[model samples]
Target: MRTAAVIGTGLIGTSVALALTRRGVTVYLDDADTTAAATAEAMGAGSMAAPESPVELAVLAVPPAHIGSVLARVQGRGLAHAYTDVASVKARPHHEIQSAGADPAGYIGGHPLAGGERSGPLAASADLFEGRLWVLTPSAHTERLVLNRALELVSLCSGVPVIMDTVAHDRAVALTSHAPHLIATIMAARLENAADESVRVSGQGLRDVIRIAAGDPSLWRDILDANADAVADVLDTYAADLGGAVTALRALGSADETRRKQAGADLDDLLRRGNRGMHAWCGNRARRPPVFCRCP
Candidate 1:
């Protein structure tokens, strides 16, 4: 906990380094792109110089696909006593480590449920993870010291720790983060070919829905590839809902009054269900009945 090395100087890595530095932990920063590490160092996140010896912990903030390789490389060099990662997917990375014949006792899986469309050291902020849920996935063979080091890192970053199994962590993110990110990108893609007049009239609702679509496509492709099954499960349900909405939209012009009425009812039900679901993140106030209308 006294000293740490951040293996990637991108947004999450730099943010973590900055937070740790602010907390008085000696942080040594590194990245494949030396300029990135230098940028973080210039921002006062940490020193770019290699540590004289092994640090207390090492945090891998690389892409999911590179996590295992980077971990093995660092561990082989005795870079740090314990290690963790901030990759979005957990299950695949754990598998990769096992396949690489890396020691699991010194490693723990982690994902900080925070970040924005912006990336790189320039976009990093010490408070990026504040009040966010940072998940940790520990295997049966994972050492208590490694897990404790990860928890300490999370604590220093002002994150709320939620322990979960690797598979559960993957599935949860598919529902909460990955699926939604894809959904946003899909929505924003529509505007690429949209009529100028149509796009010109867009409002806050459009911006809000498509905000995350600005994320790097290559990075998202890696995340989606690693957790394809879990993400597909969530998207399958969304596809069904989309099909039903399309049917309802076509029926709105039906010749039969009954058909139109049924379609209206279906659309209303979908809207109400969405309102109810929003309560999960929006808190108890969202659960209360509308003051102006008692209807569900």
Candidate 2:
């Protein structure tokens, strides 16, 4: 791509601009916050000036709720030949775009499966999306040229392309990203009133569980709201599992031997289920066992 506009100068947007600029694409950076745009420009992400005319593509790096309105407004002024977004949610923004009467053919849904807990222009990095999966959701009306432009953008950012339908994409991210963030936040919230002695001796497991809890709550709120139903569905299973674990733990400490014995069995089952999950993917394991270890 010769030219493109990145409409948000925050982490993902600026990172995209940096990546594109590194690859020799003329990138125009814009943000509602002038300081953010200037910061991105200073960091060598891209130029803050508006494009002379409609460029090759416009990447709307705005919040999920604002994508449609922003897209409609930009399209009104002929912002680019094609467009996509980096919002966490998909269906809502696509619906909003249609509602706002933006041309559907020139747009596609995009979400790069990469980020950090930190945000804004200061946290931007050119390699943030490198080697990560960037999902593209193209509708029946999406033009091949528009899809090609988006794929080129992903290639420029060193991301692998994965095509999915919009609804499936929303549900998948809700399970993997949205629900997990909420779980991490809820877990981390336990430390707010924790004793210094308790927190000071924390282990890697505790740190890992709450790592993503540091994300900006306001931005997460918008993402959760956009994909509320799907996230709720995933959280329901977590709630059920949590309840089971609580029940088993309480029973394990009961006075009755029979109850204690049954509780031990129940807890064993719970731990084994998690063990299976862990066995499925223990990051970067060099060799694989023929089968999962069944012994407890």
Candidate 3:
């Protein structure tokens, strides 16, 4: 696309604008908070002023809750030829937009599976989406032009495009992103009441597990709200696993020899399963011959 408008000047929006601008696309910037628009403009993302004419595409980078209404309003104003949103939740917003009487032909739903523990235009980077999966969800009513525009946007941002049904996309993120986010939060929340001595001995392991817990709670709440059912389903399974671990731990205190042996086996099984899962995620390189540490 030759030109585009980014309708929210937050981290994702600014990052997308920066990427498109770097690719020589004329980007128009706007946000409900004018300062955010100005901030993005100052960062060389795009012009803060209104575009003279409708751009080739418009990206609604608002929160999941606002996407439907924001899209409806922008399209109502003839803002662009085609539109897409970067909201993490897809199915709900897609259906909501349709329910709001917005034209689905001109819109496509998208989510870039990349970000940091930061928000706003200042935290945005042109490379935020590099090598990351960006999901596209187009329904039967979606127009080819809208889908193509979104694909171009993803390509310009150096993102890998994966097309999925809206519902599948929601479920996928619940397993891979949403559920994990809440897990991290729960782990991190433990630190809130932790004694200073305990927290003082923090290690990389804790940091790694709780990294995403630093994300804005308000934003995460909206995301969780949108995909509550899927997230709850994931959490239910996780709780079962946690209960198994607890049972194994309590069994470690059993007076019976058989019970103690069974507990050891259970713990070993869980650890081995975790190792296998990690190896699966790490792919072929994990199976390669390992080089031992050579430090003398």
Candidate 4:
């Protein structure tokens, strides 16, 4: 596409605009938050207003909750010839467009699986989506032109496009993204009452585990609510594993050598399986953890 409009100049939106602008595409920016959009423009990301006429594509990079309504209004107004969104969840918005009687032919559902524990235009980077997965969910009524435009946008943003049905995309993200964020929040919440000694002894392991807890709670709440059923399924499975861990830990406190050994072995097996699973997911073998030693 020669020109594109990014409708939410927050982090993802600004990053997308930056990527598009860098690649010589004329980008027009629009957001309810004028300051955010202007800031993105001043940073050379794109223009601070939508073009007078319909652009090649309009990317609605708003939160999942705002996507459907925003897209409906924009598309209704003929803001762009084709449209897509960068919301985390897809199914809800896809249904929303159909229910609202918006032209599904002009739009596709998109989600770039890349973000940081940060927010706003200032946090945006042109390379935010680099080497990351971008999912496109095109319904039966979706036009090929719109789907191609979405894929082109993903390519310009340095993302790898993976096309899947809306339902599959939502469920996959619930397991790999949403559920993990919930776990991180839970882990970090426990640290609120941690003793001074406990906090003082914090290591990289704790830091890695709770990194996502730094994300905006309000955003996460909306995302979790949107895909509650899928997220709940993941949480239920995690709860079962947690229960097993608790039972094993209690058994370790007993005097019985058999129980203690069994618990230790069980924990070891779990960790090994986790390592293998992660390695397989990344298509790589496990590497040794970095060792730090002080000279005496």
Candidate 5:
């Protein structure tokens, strides 16, 4: 595209602007905090304000909570010919736009499954979305041209494109991302006031499990709330597995040696199943590392 506008000068927004600018697409930037937008512009991301005329595309890089309203305002003001968002949750904004009687025809929903543990424009990287999955959810009313444009944007960012309905996208993210984030938070919460001795004993296993716990809680809370039912389903399944583990461990202390041995065997089988399942998920054969590069 010739030109684009990026709303919200956060990490994702700034990164997108930088990528587009690098490709020789003129980009205009707008954010509530004008200084932040100016800072992004100074960093060579884009311009400090919206273009005078309608841009070819507009990327709304705002928080999930503000996407719908911001999109409506910008589209209504003729700020862009077509628009898309980078919100994590899609269904809520999709419904919000429809309910508000905004033109969903020129709009598409997009989510890039790429980010760092940090936030804000300073953390932005032009290559943030490279090799990552970018999901697009288009309604029946969505224009073909708009869909193609969105796909082109994903390709320009070097992202893999996946199409799904809004509900399906929400559910998939709830299972794969939201639930895991919450589980990590729950694990880390136990160590909040941990003594020096206890924290000093922490190793890679615990660190790995709780790494995502460093994510912004407010952002995650909004995401979890948007897809509560799906996240709840994942949590329910996890709770069932945890219950089984507890029962098996308690059974290990039983008076009967045979019963205890059976319990131990059951636990061993469960652990083996977990290992096998993880390997399958990682596409590992015989627990070997995934082949990242192939010889010519």
Candidate 6:
């Protein structure tokens, strides 16, 4: 696209802006937090001044809860020819926009499967989405032009586009992204009251597991809340696994030899399952999906 507007100058928005700017797209940046917009602009992501006319596309990088209203407000003003969002949750915003009576013809829900523990424009990078999966969730009412514009955006950002239904997208992220963050947070929280001696013996495994736990909590709160049902379903399964693990650990101390032996087998099973899962995750990363072409 020749010109584009990024409505939220936070990490994803600014990073998208940076990528577009690098590709010679004229990017106009805006945010509720003026400092964020200025920071993005100063970092050369985009111009902070409002666009004099409608751009080819607009990226809404706002929170999931704000998507509907923000979309309504922007569509009301004829913000862009086509619009897409970078928010993680899709179903919530999709319904909200529909309920708000906003036109879906020019809008598609998107989420680029990349980010860091850090946030804001300062943490943004032009290559943040490089080689990552960028999901496109087009409503039944979404126009072909809107989908094409979003695919072009992904291509410009050097991301792979994967089309998915909104509900499936939400469930997938809940398992792959949302639950993992909460798991890390729960694991890391134990360190808060942990004896220094215990923490002092920490290793790379501990750090790696808890690294994502260091993300912005307020933002996480909104994300988790936005996809609570799906996340809860994931957590429910994990909770069962956790309970099993605990029972096995405690069984290891049993007086009965059979109980102790069974516990050992249970621990081994869990560890092996985790190893297999990791292997599958790694295996998938080496395989790239077919690239979609840019719009004519």
What are the models' TM-scores? 0.94, 0.94, 0.95, 0.93, 0.93, 0.95
**Which window of ten consecutive residues has the lowest lDDT sum in model 2?**
283-292
Name the regions of candidate 2 deviating beyond 4 angstroms: 281-296
1-296: candidate 3 lDDT, tens digit per residue: 89999999999999999999999999999998999999999999999878889999999999999988888899999999999999999989998998887899999999998885799999999999998889999999899989999999999999999999998988988987999999999999999999999999989889989999999999999999999999999999999989999999999999999999999999999998887766655553323433432211
Instruction: Give the winner by lDDT: 1 or 4.
Output: 1
Per-candidate Cα lDDT values, in order, are 0.92, 0.91, 0.91, 0.89, 0.86, 0.93
Provide backbone clash counts, one per model.
0, 0, 0, 0, 0, 0
Query: What does the lDDT read for residue 217 in candidate 1?
Result: 88
Q: Of the candidates numbered 3 and 6, which has the greater lDDT value?
A: 6
Q: Candidate 2: lDDT of 148?
A: 97
Model 5 per-residue lDDT at 205: 84
What digit string (tens of lDDT, one per residue) describes model 6 on residues 80-108?
99999998999999999989878888899
What is the C-alpha lDDT profile of model 1 across 19-82, one tens digit per residue?
Answer: 9999999999999999999999999999988899999999999999998888889999999999
Query: Positional deviation of 260 in candidate 4, in angstroms?
Result: 3.2
Instruction: Please state the error at residue 39 of candidate 5 in Å.
Output: 2.4
Please give, for residues 1-296, the per-residue lDDT of candidate 4 as tens digits: 79999999889999999999999999999989999998999999988755878899999988888877888898878888899998899899898887777889989999998886899999999999997889999999889999999999999998989899999999999998999999999999998999989888989889999999999988898899899999999999999888988888899888999999999988888888887766565553123323432112
Q: Candidate 5, residue 186: CA error in Å?
A: 0.6
Global CA lDDT of candidate 3, please? 0.91
TM-score of the candidate numbered 5? 0.93
Per-residue lDDT value at 94 in model 2: 87
Error of 6 at 209 (Å): 0.4
